[model samples]
Target: MTFENSLAFAQEQDKLDPLAHYRQQFHHPVINGQQVLYFTGNSLGLQPKSARDYINSELDEWAKWGVEGHFHGKNPWVSYHEILTPASAELVGANESEVVCMNSLTTNLHLLFVSFYQPDGKRFKIISEAKMFPSDRYLLETQVRHHGFDPDEAIIEIAPREGEFLLREQDILAAIEEHKDELALVFFGGVNYFTGQLFDMKTLTEAAHKAGALAGFDLAHAAGNVPLHLHDWNVDFAAWCSYKYLNGSAGNVAGIFVHDRHGNNTDIKRFGGWWGHDKERRFLMENNFQPMTGAEGWQISNAPVMGMAILKASLDIFAEAGMPRLRKKSLKLTAYLEYIFNQVVAMFPDYQLQIITPTEPEKRGCQLSIKLIGSDKKFFEALTQAGVIADFREPDVIRLSPTPLYNSFEDVYRFGETLRNLLSQSHH
Candidate 1:
């Protein structure tokens, strides 16, 4: 459990791991002709070895089938997004009908909001975390103003207690209690991008429901990294991109989950398109707007076959390993990284690497956000030059994510060793 044991234990655990072979399935990035120790799956996942083949299949069909590809091609383009449903629903713990792979993350967030964020005079407020991803904060702020409310009074931003890196569950619950009367909706990132803390979705959903509000999540960071039960948790809606931890390519399609409870609610008010029109009468060209059954009803454009192909390859890998097994491996891998970090901190009294992520695995995914005291951009740039692929957030945090599918225990060990060397040479 200690740093000294981590290196050996990681190696031994790798030897016994059934999923160890998966590491070889990704194409590791080569920097300056040397392989880098990549720990940034929190931002962009490595390409799966099968990604090329999967994508090529679609290209081949497009070339051979041409105009007929929409209906008659091998893996018909007309319903390509359908192929991803079974795997995506399984990954997110939703019923097959409740999930769909469609547009990008932020776009899906907007669509879901259109349906769920109806504000009235007394209940025209939104509650979200203070330091959300900039896009989310912007979107929510815009939504409040669109509904004719002042952003300052209508937006209930939840900040961490002073000196705390993450929000306590109790505080989040209390915030809901305090603002329950005016709160219209609760939208939060499933895991905080900066702090890498995973909120308790079940508790959050229950609290929001008890307060008579709709609860939704942006799972961009949590999606392939954490196990989610959108259905059981009664989450009204959620969205995520597949590029991170899912091994899909950058800008690949994102997915959405709408609870089965809302499947046929036509009064929800959505911005509709032909794809969302009922498939049976889709070509009838009648102007009457009849929506599809579940989350697929939210689609606005035709399926992007190329993007779905990449996601299919990635989902196939996830289906093989299953999340329960991957999460177990993930915990050990991240704990080893922390063990090494703790040792380095103890060895140098003046130097410090403070972990901003939650201490408990249940409250976080694979990422550990380390605030390097007295460190700067130069320090992070040096790590990149040294073939360590961790990401640097603005100000002082460095994020390292030891992805369970690809990162080894040795990777975490080497990163800590390199950081130790970097600190010892500093003029403290």
Candidate 2:
């Protein structure tokens, strides 16, 4: 397919897009009189227009029935989370029993580690990619310390070969094999937040199992952006935030996936709470904790109805769009974004911008992290002033994501146009 870097071409593509209508479902922010080209859905997704009604319904139920709202509301706060199970499961390719919407990202990671990241004497070290999201690093460092082990000794951080920006698959597998004897767990971001690199999850999970180590991923950037098969891949465990690509609202409830093997394991200990207990006996409130089967067994507290309501509104749209369709559109949309950037590069010629994200579509998602040559945050500020909503990582990377659900081909073309103008001005 020949790609065109023109407004007319973009509009034509948008006119033909099957997912184009979904854009109307979100509320875009206005800068002057026009809506800004939002590219930070990789951070906090745009709110679904229906979010208000979904949340207000919950508020209304609470106002009407007070405590009885738990069981009497239209959505039934008692089992509100169950409503999202099938769609949420479909989003990440897991069974309903294998996944659950629960605590926030790091909190869920800790909960998962409690059962999976146990460090015995012989196999105590954990391996992960270097320069991952800071939250994950902090979690790994503190988790190692909590187990009476020094982070420096217990954590192995893999980096790309010098002068490279992405991790080689072979290097990752080699590291896992090298440390197989001492490896207790292997964790990675499904789609790295800064680099936007989508790690090969299935192979990594296979390698971990071959090495007798638990494999898990922080899918904060990968969850809704990519089509995942967590259950079929035999991934041991995974955690993700809903706010990013899931479009579940800021600070929304996160999700977790525990494979059938572990989800069914009654012996695996977890941080128990009343919410995780069997629903039939939950009101009984026995002193003994009887864990619910599957990922639900890891829940720690009651559901946040408001957050889940906003999440439900977003999930409904996703269910309607379907992950396969979303993934298909995303690949083409993201590729066009890259193509536009390349066109800008040729036009500018003076700026040293290079896309740090992998050129391979399968190795990336919607984000294209550009390494802006010889520029800093001020460059990002310039783009922001021009109504660009991209994220700037320290040093020199501007991450622009053209989300298929909300962003149009016109949006991508306009962003490229804005960037070309900005870069040309900077050069002058």
Relative to the true structure, candidate 1 reaches a TM of: 0.97
Per-residue lDDT over 1-428 for candidate 1, one digit per residue giving the tens place of the 0 to 100 score: 44464467667777887889999999999989999999999999999899889889989888898978898877899998999999899989999999999989999998898999999669888888998999999889888888888899988888999988888888888889999998889899999999999999999999999999999999999988999999999999999999998878898899999998886676579989999999998889899788988998899899988888988988999999899999998998899888888887788887666999999988899999989787777878988988899999999999999999999888888887887787678735
Top-lDDT candidate index: 2
RMSD of 2: 0.9
Worst 10 residues of 1 by lDDT: 1-10
TM-scores for all candidates: the values are 0.97, 0.99
Q: In the order shown, what is each candidate's alpha-carbon RMSD?
A: 1.3, 0.9
- Which ranges of candidate 1 are over 4 A from the true structure? 1-8
Task: Assess each prediction's global lDDT (C-alpha) against the native.
Answer: 0.89, 0.93
Q: Which ten residues in a row have the lowest lDDT in candidate 2?
A: 344-353
Q: Specify the highest-TM-score model's number.
A: 2
Give model 2's TM-score versus the native structure: 0.99
